[model samples]
Structures are given as C-alpha cells and as structure tokens.
Target chain A: MDLNLTILGCHSATPRANAFPTSQYLEINNRHFLIDCGEGTQRQMRKYKIGFSKINHIFISHLHGDHFFGLIGLISTFGILNREKPLHIYGPKGIKEVTILQLKLSKSWTKYDIIFHELSSKESEVIFEDEKVTVKTIPLDHRVYTNGFLFTEKPKLKKLHIEKIKQYDEIEKCDYNNLKSGKDFKLSSGEIIPNNQLTLEPDTPKSFAFCSDTSYKPDIVPIIKDVDVLYHEATFLKDREDLCEKTKHSTAEQAASIADQANAGKLIIGHYSSRYKDIAEFKKEAETVFSNVELAEAGKRYSINSYPIEILN
Target chain B: MDLNLTILGCHSATPRANAFPTSQYLEINNRHFLIDCGEGTQRQMRKYKIGFSKINHIFISHLHGDHFFGLIGLISTFGILNREKPLHIYGPKGIKEVTILQLKLSKSWTKYDIIFHELSSKESEVIFEDEKVTVKTIPLDHRVYTNGFLFTEKPKLKKLHIEKIKQYDEIEKCDYNNLKSGKDFKLSSGEIIPNNQLTLEPDTPKSFAFCSDTSYKPDIVPIIKDVDVLYHEATFLKDREDLCEKTKHSTAEQAASIADQANAGKLIIGHYSSRYKDIAEFKKEAETVFSNVELAEAGKRYSINSYPIEILN
Candidate 1:
C-alpha cells in the first residue's frame, strides 16, 4: 500500500496564468481522495494524469471560493461522464445547500448518489473510517468556519515469518491466520510459540495532515502531532506578516513553527501568495526554522513513507 | 468604436486539458461585457490580455454550472484585487440567491457593489442598456430556463466629413458636434448644409447574437435576424442527432440552419462536445448549410465589422 499526495494547485486568493488556487489529490491505502478542489481542478487533474473515476471521496476545508469553487464543476463533469458510483463529500455545513442549488437551477440531477457529510463541529472528530484508512477533522482557526483533514492508515496485520511457521507442521494455513493476528501458536506436543517469535510486526501506520488557509494558531499542533507528512499553508512571507495577520493567513515562518512544534516527519509548504515573484524566499524562510521543508509544486507527488528523503520540489 | 468578440472558452460539458467550457468577452463600442463565464474564465481573460477592470457588465445565459461557475470566482478575485467600481451581473432569476448564499457563507463581502439583474420573463426584453450598447434577451429552448443575449451597439453618431467641414470657415469646432449628431449645419450667411452632405453615416450599428445550449428552434431567427455575427451552440455532430434531441442540444447542421434562416452576416459555431476528437467535422457539417461559417477556437478574436473575412480559424 502506498500513501502519496499530489499537488493540483497551491496558490492563494486568486488563480493566475501559471499558478492555481488550492487543490490536492491524496492516495492512501489504495483509496483516492480529493482535497480542497479549487477552480480549474479538473483541468489540473487531467494535466497530472489523475483519472477522475478513481476519486470516490472529496474533502473540502471551507466555503471560500478558491477552496471549493471547482466542486460544482467537478460534480457536473461527473454527471456528464455518467458516473454511477456514489461519491462522498465531507465539508463544513453550507456545502450541501450550495451544491444542491446549483444542480437544481441547472436541472442537472446527477445519476450517482452524492452523500454529503456536513460538519460544523469545533472539536476534532473522526469523519470517515473504513477497513484501510480513518479520516478525522482538525478544527482550524480562520476568518470563516474551517477544518483541516487528517488521514491515517489503519494499523496493518502482523506479517507471518514463513521460515519459522513452516518448522511447525502442526500450524496449518488456518492457524497461520491466528498467528498473523498477533496470537501465540499452540502445538499439539504441548509446546507454546510466542507471537513475536512466529511473526514480525508490520510497518507502522502512515499519517498525513493537510492544514490550510488558517491563522498561526498552535492549538492544532496536538491534533496533527507526529504525522508522517504535514502540508501547511504558507500564504505570505515574513515581509508581508502584517497582511498575513490581517487576513488570518500564515507566513512561511509560522508554517515552519507549526511543523516543528508538531514534530512532523516531513513538512511541505504551499498556498503561495501571488505578490511574491520569487518562491525561493519561502524555502529559505521555512528552512531557517525547519530542516526537512519541501516546497509544494503543482503536479508533484510526495510519498509519506519516504520521509527525510525528498521526492520532488 | 470597435465591436470585437474574444473567445475565452468554447468546449461544452466538461473542461479538458486544452479545451475549456463556454466563456466569451465582447467589446462593443468601447464597453466591455463578459458573456457566459465558465470555469477558468479569469485565467482565459488573462491569457488573452483582457483587463479585469475593463469588464463592468456580465451576462449569464442560464444557471448551468459551466456558464456561471466562473462568475463567483471572478467576483472573489475582484474583491481580492480591491476593485472599487460596482460590477453588474444580469442572469436568470435564481442567480442572485446562488451567488449571495456563497458569499454569505464565505463571509467575503466584496468592497465593490455587485448588482444582479435577474430575468425571468419569456418575452424578449432589454435587460441592459448604456450609452453605447443595448442588450436584449432571446428566450431559448433548453432543458432548463435559458436565454441567449443579443448585444447590439447603439446607433453611432455620424462621422464628420473633415474635408467638407473644413471648406466652411464659419463651422467652429463646437458646431461640428451638432453636425455629427445628424443636425444640418446652419451658416451665418443663412446657408444650410444638409446632414448627409456634411457627414457620412457611422458604420452600421453592429449586432452580435449569442445562442448557446439551446435546441434547434427557428423562432429565434426573427429576433437575431440579419445580425452582423451569430455564435450558436453546436454541441453535437449529425451522428449524434438523436442525443441532441434527447438532451435539447443542437447539432452543427441545426446551428447552421438557424444562421441561414436568420440571414446572418457570419456564423461561428461552438460549445463542442467532448466526445468529438476532431473539430473539423463540425466545420464541414455546418458549411454544407451556411457558407460563411467558422469554428470557435479558444483565445480567438472575431471582429463583427469584418464579416466574410475570417480573422482566425
């Protein structure tokens, strides 16, 4: 199983010729999810060769246009493509009304089921859980009601040591399932084999945190602490710290501070403001506070397991 | 006073990597207006070098997501840019509710005034009028409540014959204004010069009819009859005629039929279906019915006054 994050867009406020607003595609435990679909997200997905049918879940952080304007277009496109699979969407409360109104006015009732999980809770809560992954919401402080999502892979079953298991002929294939579940193996000859001796624990579960468009509040550090990968928004530089405070956005320094406090394995900073002509300054600013900082570029993919080892900038 | 049309996007249904949905910018008599702002329209405008401040009026054809999805993003961008001028949006009745709800949820009240003129009348009515242009709505036949806009440049002032006016020394610069307004010049010697002899008629007031996402209805022919330029939606080819009828969309041949019946000066067909890999087929199909036909391409500009002479393929 692979845990990967693909940056569809990373600019802030408005979309430009080369830079787009916030949108990302996350692939975890063989499940695909779209996060914060900004305007022109579908085009970005096409440009990155991400198939539309693979995305069954979409998570929106807030009601800002840049964060969710592309949602209606994507839903309409899904309808055009005649998608039959039910699509799940998790977001703040007003999303259902906005999507329904647009669909009603256009008379484009989709053929697929659109299950909306509207959230207004201020506390961290699990929003989705399946066999492979569990998704939770991290309450964020912003001008409007917003929440960041935390995706964590469920703990894997212990892998069976083939050589050790084969030595016990009494342990059949049926009994091996029990050993893989972290149970001791009992022999007919009254010999007990320890669970650790029979099997080795699987790799630790991977976790990813996506926090964007929020102020530099340390309250979320506890919720996103120890995540394998953390993507925090760096909308402004230190020079524009005044604007960042006024707009409730974070600077590169603030993002790095959050990552450092959370002890994240890797830190990726994006959501760059169009005012800054050079992006190198952002990297320099964040590197001063955090050593393992990566710049989020569009169409670039980052693996959570490849921590400390940079993928692409 | 130039009447020009810039194709911001022309594809139908979904936006692709290279093809965009329906969006167009019309410059008529020094006034700029946006027609059917689909997704990625602002980026398209930037790509074509159309300034955001230049557009004060936006006319939406219907409530379809592709037609109006970009409107909210553009409004948000204007707010981000600190636009002070009031922006006017004219669309179907439900547009106001949809736009207002999104803004309220985001708490992004724009600094500029957004005045929405919602139209519901089935009869053709003047929805917008200024000193230079008058926009009328042509009720269209579609699955939902839809209307196409007819942008007509107000009758221009007669051009002054500089050589003829110079010969009369008694004609002052201030008096030339009266002659341009179609008033006969009265000399101090009591000699009256006829308006036609002193000035030439301004280039016949140019008109452009944009009929999109509508079925093949001949009734609109009278409303858009003999227009300088007609852009009709041809969402399908002859092979998909049945699908067109079922979806209330038009084929290339049907679009050309409407142009021929209206005796349009020139015809441009767009809103291409994503299913068609080759666009030349649409041109070949429409040319069989109307000789002066062109395919609408993204970023292409069409001059209404330059009929019969193709600007770009």
Candidate 2:
C-alpha cells in the first residue's frame, strides 16, 4: 500500500500572506486527486510541484469560497495549457452553473471537455469506482450542503506460494492464474489441495478519509470506520468549544474524539481559525483524546503507509 | 501631487512563482483602487501590505481569467471580515452577473452592499468621479470586449500667496476660500488683483492610465495625452511582433510608440509573456523609442511624483 497526502492550505475563514485556506492533494494507487481548492491552491500546487496534467478528477466538498474558489482559475489555466483530456469535477448542486457562467462571461470556453458530477445525495454512497480504487461520500452536517470523501484501494488478487506449488507436478504454469484466484487445485489422482494452503493472503487494502468544515457529526464515524488515515477539521480548541456549535465547526478535542471512535490508524487535524496564535495547542489538546495525532501544516506531506506515519516538510 | 503605484502581478497568461497575473494597487490623491485582480491578487495585496479595508473600488480590465479571477475570493474575504462599507466594482457588462452568482451559490451573502458599475461603451467616458479623482474608460482593441482605464487627479485648489496677500491688507482671511477658487479679489477701492497674480498656480495634477490586453491602438493617444504616467501591456517584444496582431496584444516597441506619441512623462511596460527569459528586454526595447521606461516587477512600487521616478522594492 502506497499513499501520500500533501496539505496545501489549511487555515480557516480568510487567507493571509502566511495563512492559506483549505486545499489538499492526494495520491493513492498512482491516481491523483485534488480536494477542496481554495484561492491560492494553484500557487500551492506549483510550490509543491504537483503537475497540472496529473489530475483528471477534482472533488469539491462544498460551495464555500475557502473550499472551491480556485476551481475556475485552475480550469482556465488548463485551457491555456491546451489540455486535451476531459476533466471531471464532483461537487454539490449548482457547481456546474456557477462554473459555466464564469467561463461563458470570460469567453474562455476551454477546448477540453468539462464533465461535472453534481452530488445532492444525503446518504453515504459510492460515487467513483475503478479497477484500482473506490470513492464514497460521507454526508456531513454543516451550514451548507457538504460531503466528505472516503477513498479506498480495491482488494488485490491472491498470491501463489511458488515453493508450495512446485511440490505438486499437476500444478502446471497454465493453471497458475486459476490457483491465484483462490481455486482448489484438483489432481488426476482424485486428490484436492486446499486453496488457502496453496496461496498466502495478500496485504490488506489501505483507505483514507477526508472531512472538513463540519460540526461534530457522530454518524460519519460509522461510514469511515477503521480508515487507515482520517483528516478532519479542527477549527478551534476546547476553550472555544462554545463557538464550534454556532459556527458549525469542530474543536480539536471533538475531531480527536471522532478519530478515536472510528478507531482510525492516524488522525490529521487542520482548518485552524486565524484567531489562534499557536497551532501547537491544537496538537496538545487533540493528543489528550487520541494517542496518534498530527497537526496539518501547509506544504507538509504525510505518508501513512510507513510505520509511525512518515511526515515530510 | 502624490501618486504611488504598486505592481501586484504583471504576467501575461498564467501566474507563476515570481510572476503574477495582472493586478495593481494605485494610490492617487489619497484614493486606493485595485485594477485587474488575477488569481493570486489578494495574496499579493497582503504581501504588499495593502489593507483590505483601504480598497473601496476595484476595476477589471477584461473578462479574461488572469485579469479578474480573484474578484470572487477577495469579495468573499470581505464578507468574512464583516466589512460594513459597500464595495464598488467597475467592469464589463457581465461582471455583476458572474460575481453575484458565485456569492449566491456560496450562501455567503455579504452584509455589506456590492455596488457594481457595469460598463458597455466603446468610447472614452468618465465612469467614476469624486472630489479628488476621476476615472474614465479607455476603449482598447482586444480579442474580447475589453477597456483600459485612465485615472486623473482633479485640479487642486489654488494656493494662497501669504506674502502677496500681506502686501494688500484688504484681502481678509474670510476671502481666502474665494481666492483659492481662482477668483480675483475685489478691493474696496474698486481695484482688482488678478487671480493669477494673487495665487501661484498649484502643482499640475497627476494622472495615470492603465492599458492592458490590447493591441496597438494609437487612437487612444489623444484621450490620454500629457498623462503623467502610462502603464501599458507589452506582452511580447519586437521579435514576437507577429503574435501581437493575432493575440490582440502589444509589443514593447508598440507600447513605447504609444507613450511617445502621447508624450507621457513615464512609461511602465508589463504583462510580459512567460516565454521571455528576461524582463529587462522589455525595458531595453521600449527605451529605444521612449526615453524613460520601467519594467514591471512584483512587489515594486513606482512613485512618479519624485524626480527620476522613485522606485522602492
């Protein structure tokens, strides 16, 4: 399992010279996905060396400017770059209308086709699927209609125990694929070799969940249970818990509580309000609730496949 | 006369690390105006220490994404900051529709009013005027419906010659405002002191013209003649003069030709295409025809009021 996540911008409310809004780049199973592009996301992508052509799919959490304001700009740049492939965008309803209107007014209709998938479902359902990965939506409670995305790698085919298979002469090279498919090996002597004994179990698939700008919603834990990595919004600390309810945000303690309830392997918390002077306090408070916690910083990359969660700045 | 210009972003197409798109902060006669906000204009404003509240008016040159993609983000930030004063936006006919659509979809309606002044004129016309400054649209030839802007400070009140007034005690302090209005003072003896003799002529009013994303339209020389400063888009050098016609852009030599014909005090050329390796070439080529030329660089401030044109990094 190989998965890498880059935090582009994580600050909340407004963008400052030092503080950017929420945007991230995720790479899993050699597939690239951009989540929640804020105002400076493209610059951040350039800073982080994320190629523009690598991304064919973009997932927007909601219609908030902090989450998706850079979509139109990025799309226009693709036109300037002469991208020929069609781009797919998934977001809340009305996304296509707003995007198309800007394009029409600018008279910058891209030669490349734009495929929009507007999601209005309230229930958690799979929205994207391929041979390698599947993406599901985790409906969240927020001021606006929003959804968190869960990305999971599909299960791998069974691996054959080459040394054990060599012991049986009946197991020819032509039957290797069938044996790898977890079928029992039948011999001409009317004897049967169990599939489990002939093949060892493959490595477990990895999963990542991204949730942001939502209040304390316990129901999401069930949808993202046992996720290898969970990135949640922690806009404030426990001291400002009272503001969380009104703002429809979550505190660091609340984010960690959700991570603990879901038994996530690791938790990354971000979307800090600009009012906070220190982000270390978020980590200190979240650690008390969940043992494994990491603070999301701009330009930081987290690799959960490595033991102890390898982080690169 | 005090006029300061800050180059926020002056690149032609997409924004790069060091090259911004097209955005400038102009301070003329104590009025702040933002011109052509590209994708990262707000961040550049923060870098240049331009206060968000200081800007009351924003002017867009055209509907190109690089020219005005940052408008929605800046407007949304104003909402998050709880700005109470109404924001005035001046641009093309579709500016209001595109901006309002984004705000509406975000559900982040601002408490402050957004006064949009949409322009659809093909001739030079005054769009905004107050006591100190006047802004007029300079129609340009572009691929789309585009317009340049000319900002000029109104002629100031005449200065009161204290020494000359002391020579004639009949010129009472109460009559000072009347004299400042360029009115001749009438003595009780029926002898009139000529207005020019009573007050020295005030410093010549300063003017700045912003022309971008346009081809060589020499017809505008009469409209902006004797302008103190001219900021023109030189997207290509003389070597790529062929592209200017097809792309509806101007070369360095063409920009210099316009400045020379208009008799501008200073010529600032920007909006350089990314293909050029060095921006110094723009200044070199422009200076061949125009004596005083400056290359636009991000974070540089040019003050034309001072001798030799004060440039601060």
lDDT of 2 by residue, B233-279 (tens): 99999898899988999999999999999999999999999999988
Clashing residue pairs in candidate 1, if any? none
Q: Taking the candidates in order, what DockQ does each have?
A: 0.85, 0.79
Best candidate according to TM-score: 1
What are the per-residue Cα lDDT tens digits for candidate 1 across B93-201? 8999999998998999999999999999999999988898899999999988899999998888999999998888988898878888999988898988899998998
The TM-score obtained by chain A of candidate 1 when compared with the true chain A: 0.97
Weakest 10 consecutive residues, lDDT, candidate 2 chain A?
A303-312
Query: Can you write out model 1's per-residue Cα lDDT over A1-313, one digit (the tens) per residue?
Result: 4688999999988888888889999999898999999999998999999999999999999999889999999999999988999999999999999999999988899999999999999999999999989999989888998999999999988999999889888889888778878999777888889999989888788999999889998999999999889999999998988998898899999999999999988889999988889998999999999998889999898876654545753
In model 2, how large is the Cα lDDT of residue B257?
A: 99
TM-score of 1: 0.97
- The alpha-carbon deviation from the true structure for residue B120 of candidate 1, after best TM-score superposition, in angstroms, is 1.2
> What interface RMSD does every candidate have?
0.7, 1.0
Give the runs in model 1 whose Cα sits over 4 Å from its true position.
Answer: A307-313, B310-313
